[model samples]
Target: MSSRFKMSDLGLLCFYLGIEVQQGHDGIKLLQSAYARKILERAGMGSCNPCHTPMEHRLKLSKASTTAPVDATKYRGLVGCLRYLVHTRPNISFAIGYVSRFMEQPIVEHLNAVKRILRYIAGTLDYGCHYKHGG
Candidate 1:
C-alpha cells in the first residue's frame, strides 16, 4: 500500500480516526478519553456522578413488551459512534456491543444505559489497551 501511494510519515500517531494514541516505554496505548469526555459534556453528563459499570448487571435489552420511551435517532447515533470508538478501544466493547443489539428500537432505559456507559468512560478516562512497543 505504501509503495503504491505516497504517504507522509506522521510520526508516532498521537491522534488518528478520532482515537488518541500515547507512546510509552512499554507500549502504545489507545484511548478515546477526550472524545468520551466531549460526548458526556454534550449529553449533559460531564459533571454527573460516576458509576462502576456502564449498565446494570441485569440489563436485558430487546425490542420488548415493556420498555421506557426515548429518542430513537439519538440512541442510534450514540451507539454508532461508540461502535466506532471500539475499534481502537476495546475496553468498552462488550458493553457497547450489548446495547447495540437494541438500536433499532431503543427506549429511555436504553438511552440512560448508554449515558451510563459514557459516564463510566468519564470516570475511567485513563483506561485503554496497550500494545507492546516491540511487537
Candidate 2:
C-alpha cells in the first residue's frame, strides 16, 4: 500500500485517530485523554468537577424506573464513547456496562450515572496503561 500510494515516512507516531502513543525504551504507552475530554465537551461538561470513582459502589439502574426519561440518542452516544474508551480504561468497564443497559430507555437517573463516569474520566485523563517490551 505504501509503495502504491507513494506514502512518505512520518517518523514515530504520537497520535493516531484518538489514541496517543508514546514509545520509549521500556515499552509503549497508549492514551485517549483527548478523546475522553472531547466526550465531556460534547456532553457540555468540560469544566465539570471530577469524580473519584466512575460510579457508586453497588449502584443499580432500573428499566422500569419512575424517573423522567432523558434523551435516548444523547445517552447512547455518551455510552458508546465510554465503551470505546474501555480499550484503554478497564477501570470504568463495569460502570459503563451497567449504564449501557439503559441506553434503550435512558432516564435522568441513568444519565446521572453516566455523567459520574465522565467526571471520573475528567480526573483521570492522564491515566493509561504502559506495555513493557515483550520478547
- Mind giving the per-residue lDDT tens digits that candidate 1 earns over 1-135? 889999888778798877888988998888877877777776777888888887788877667747667788878888887787677667788999888888777777788779889878777877877889666
Best by TM-score: 2
Instruction: Please list the C-alpha lDDT of all candidates, in the order they appear.
Output: 0.80, 0.91
Alpha-carbon lDDT of model 2: 0.91
TM-score of 1: 0.82
Model 1 CA deviation exceeding 4 Å by range: 1-10
49: Cα error in model 1, Å: 1.1
Q: What is the lDDT of residue 17 in candidate 1?
A: 72
